[model samples]
Target: MIFEKFGKKRESAPPHQATPTDDSVSISRRNFLKKTGLFISGAVVGEHESEKFLKKIFKVPSAEVSPKEAVKIMPHKEKHVSAHSPEALSEPSPEVSTETSKESSPLDAYSFLDGQIHPVAIPTGELAGNTFSDLYAMYLGMPNGTVVPETLHVDFKENLATLWRKKFNLPARSHDERVEREQLQFLEEHHNLMNLAEYVYRSYDAKSPNTMTLEEYRNDVVGAVEKSRKVFVDTLPLVPTSASEDGVFSKDKISLISKMGESLTADTLMSLSFTELMPLDKGSANAQVFGFLLRNAGVDFIDRIPSVYDMLESFGPYQITPDALSPKSAGSWATQVLSALPLGFMPWNVDELLRGKENIAAYTLAMLNIAQFIGTRNSAQLKCLSEVMHTLPSTQRAKAVLSFVAAAHHRPHEAYDAFDAFIWSMYVERAHSFREEDILRHIPTKDLREYTGKALANYRFLASGASVNNST
Candidate 1:
């Protein structure tokens, strides 16, 4: 989910939206980028360069549909690797699958591959294939993933240590030179993700006939992690760590909210990002590890990066949902404001979620606040959370809270409506099947329960590592 942003709603009411289509009225890329608020780096584009100078766009569908259509083309229709673990589902499209290493890969893994520079026999995934490892197989040029993302991350670090080691010369908003010395911790933790993204770009550029590259890859990745990390750390004292823990954001209580595309399943539109929180001990390296989760949770590599489609739906790795900023979502906004008070969020801090001013921090806090509300012990409005929370082990409740947050992220009030249906199912006739209208919300996902259930089980697998890397 990079804590991918898709959907959110206060009530079980759906946010009105036009269904996306591949062929229809089109908007210019410049206007679309402007509307998305991601047309950053004027310096990169400058005064005279053609729009082609902007690399953010990959392939503009020749037909030129709406910006929202971009979300539909890729993983939106893609299925999970397996129904079991993150990678364990049915076969994934080759680019997203995790493949075992060849033991000896062709020295010709890339167009850039040459004899003097041997294809380093790096650690590859146990399963079939994924972009991260594919990028890694190309990063120094090697091979990544467990649907159990840890398997991905574990070997990810080993496989692409070269990419992971890349760092920034300085932070985005570099302070005084002396102040920069004090911010060494930030330097060590936050800088590498964007740099790795840069290498991921070059890796593809080095490809035989590169099909795609998001020139704006750096801006999007930076928005997700770099800028987000800086703000998250500054407000570390104010955010809540977990719903279970008292509202204290500290080193000892690190509240993690992750959006892993890998956690997405068949029913859950592959277009949407899925979220889960896996706790890690807080130490000097805490934020850095959290950064890794934030990165992979949404779009881990070059190809998966949020496209122009993500421009309206969600932004950043945290998948910053629109409801937080949408004026019509006042009720949800109000609840967030009132709930966030005890945690000491200022008016601006709360506004940051929707404004896209501070990407990840706002996204993290927004997701956490929603998770906390959903995880609240006796919320009558959120019996879904309470009911699910009861069935889970104490350790798993946080993951469940986040799963619902993620499910709801893609479609407004989906989790709430699904829960209401689930709760009603307890009283509904247990016959083979009943009237679709009376029983289902016409969200069109008649199998919403199965989707949410798979989500819960998928996340459980993530925390448990039960299947050894979300693989078959």
Candidate 2:
């Protein structure tokens, strides 16, 4: 239904556009960089590089700086924001201004994979087919908090029996019962350790103002526990004529998944990084242990998957698998996972959904990914891509690159070939999609191209070759 609305709006809205002016067109790359807030290190290209590029392109006074010149520019410095809990977004406080009451907590700046290694630089060679287990230890060792004993409990059989016996109040019957009870008790101890692991993982939030108070966290955890219990009950097998028919926790996995889906709230999932919360590989990980309970909920709940992606991003970017050597191969993994994800579930567009920032860099990246995959690469096609990409702020270029690299891995050549190919397509699409008529009537601007061309130049400078293929 939501997609239906999107389709209708796409068809009904006036397409975006810019009109040709009698005045000379100013489409230099350098000037555009400064205008779009994508200006990086100009130590490589003087501040006036865009102006120079414009001059050369149109025989104007603009200076011409080569692409290599722009790449030398160091990226702008950023202030770091700290880890925040999900409930923290909505907490009522005197510290929050009345004006910003409606806003959710901003995304955390912590990187999931640690450090600022470029994806292009990583060698993804021997790691291609390594089972997730081979990489598990490394992930556990990550300092942003990967280890958890309660969540990582390895004795699933014992844990299951314990949970079953406790929930069902089964009586001790024989030597077998004695063994099961002992196993269950052992699992209980192990599961506690897993819980501690997650606590350590989430401990980083202690540094942020948005981190939940101990009281609030306790409440949220209790709520989450209750929700999980309800799901368990709903998924429990129906009782037969005899009450003694209490079998183990066995039923269709999908049924359990559906129950879990109903039990899950966006807030609960949003509270922790996806990886920490969903650590499917962890022995006692709730998401791994209980996630199967929600599989039947369908892709709508796919939003849960982003929980891990968010965790990964919070940890920064992981550059390599245990054995993979080619950065491209590793880079492509994110592309495949992200591309398969539906746009609705992405974290980039909460504002866009409310009809704000139609040209967010993250949103444009998704669109660009789709366009490049679906359309032939051409100048007209790239023009459309550029139209949108140029509109995004420079800070978002890395994000755009990250998502694109992820999608392109499946078809490496296509990804490499379509880099600029998609950009050009976007320019054309933006032109066709522009509602020139609407703008002319409702907007006071005489020429969209003036600002747009400048914006494009700046965006290119910001996004230009931070080395998508190799770690620069």
Candidate 3:
């Protein structure tokens, strides 16, 4: 993305200007102070003091004065030369062009972070290349129209890392330690589901054997699924059908039975009626609710569960529950719950889905399924989710998906914070007036609420005039 700087032609200085003299040709204090405005006090300076002051002001080498010094010498030569006029001395010296002065001025260049501006030093040396400028444009673009070099040097890297740590409210730790701490926090939160949680943790951990290769990572995930399956099977009742066919009637089943009664004759109803009817299962109810909401929201669901299951299974390895599944046995059961919407549903307007409790539940269940599938932190799964999220109609829903993914993963806090930064960048280009809090408010998921608070606090810290330069 880097662009090469187009070299602009410069006008040459007029030949009438006098060449600069060496330090040996010293001007008196009165003449020097009047020309360069380096007057320390009203008192007159000696010859040696004038030389030192001139050298300091011009930043010239001991052996030679810079071209700017030629202007100071021109004033003294007024009586000697009629061609070298005062106007020539007033003209911008060749060495100090307007563009160069503007580039070096701190007032002309600033960086934006969460909508606040901070002065940035102009880059120099190899760092002056276009790569850094493109990087800034890609990530943290300049809010002001001024073009300043934004390089990736030691200072810039330190600033970014410091900003990241401050946003997360994390203590000073190496990247490895931070990852470990996050993993441990995850384990503490999901201790009851340690087998699956640990599998996800180890799979994503940089130090683990699971990350040694793609095949190794896949094998580890499969092993975790097998372990979870064993636990589920061991706890299962001896007669599965008996438990499934319990006499308790679900609300939907009760409504159905009541409707059937209305169509039946009194004698026929008495003979055919059973003492108890099994209620619709929780999964069926969720599916029914999901279908209803989707239909209401203008989505046509043709064979919701089957179609959705097919799509979910195609997303590589996903285990809805520990039960036997397809597309690499570790597939998720939540797929059936999420499948209510058609596969081609992209740029989906989820505003309608946020209206009612049933819609929320259906959406939550679908997200939960997606979270489970992504919990493994498999690269392929993340890539797929990223693609799907981008296809979402609005940035709000994309952020919601990101928040859900973060919540379902091992490091929800870190994930949420990172996405917050991303969201800020996205809005910077899309809506200049929209603040980070404004964008955060639109995110539908509660999972990101706490993280959003922390992120805002960090932003406030930056906005409160706590300087990035002051950070360690």
TM-score of each: 0.33, 0.19, 0.16
| Candidate closest to the true structure, highest TM-score | 1
**Candidate 1 regions off by >4 Å?**
1-304, 307-316, 321-403, 424-454, 466-472
- Model 3, 1-472: lDDT tens digits are 0000111111232110001111222333224322322122211112222233233322344245422232222122213211112222122212322222212311111011112222234333222332322112212233223333443222222223222222223333323645445533532332222221111211111111111221222233344333333332222222111111322333433232222222222111111110000011122221222222222211211111110111111000111211111011112222222232334221121111112111222223223323233333334444434443343354334334433332222233334344444444554455323344554554434434443333233223322333222221
Q: Count the backbone clashes (under 3 Å) in each candidate.
A: 52, 91, 11
The alpha-carbon lDDT assigned to residue 152 of candidate 2 equals 31
Question: Local distance difference test, per candidate?
Answer: 0.30, 0.26, 0.25
Model 2 spans with C-alpha error above 4 angstroms: 1-135, 138-366, 369-472
Query: Which prediction has the highest lDDT against the true structure?
Result: 1
TM value for model 3: 0.16
Model with the higher lDDT, candidate 1 or 2: 1
Name the weakest run of 10 consecutive residues (lDDT summed) in model 1: 106-115
RMSD of each: 19.5, 28.5, 33.7
lDDT of 2 at 307: 15
Q: How close is candidate 1 to the true structure, as a TM-score?
A: 0.33
lDDT of 1 at 359: 38
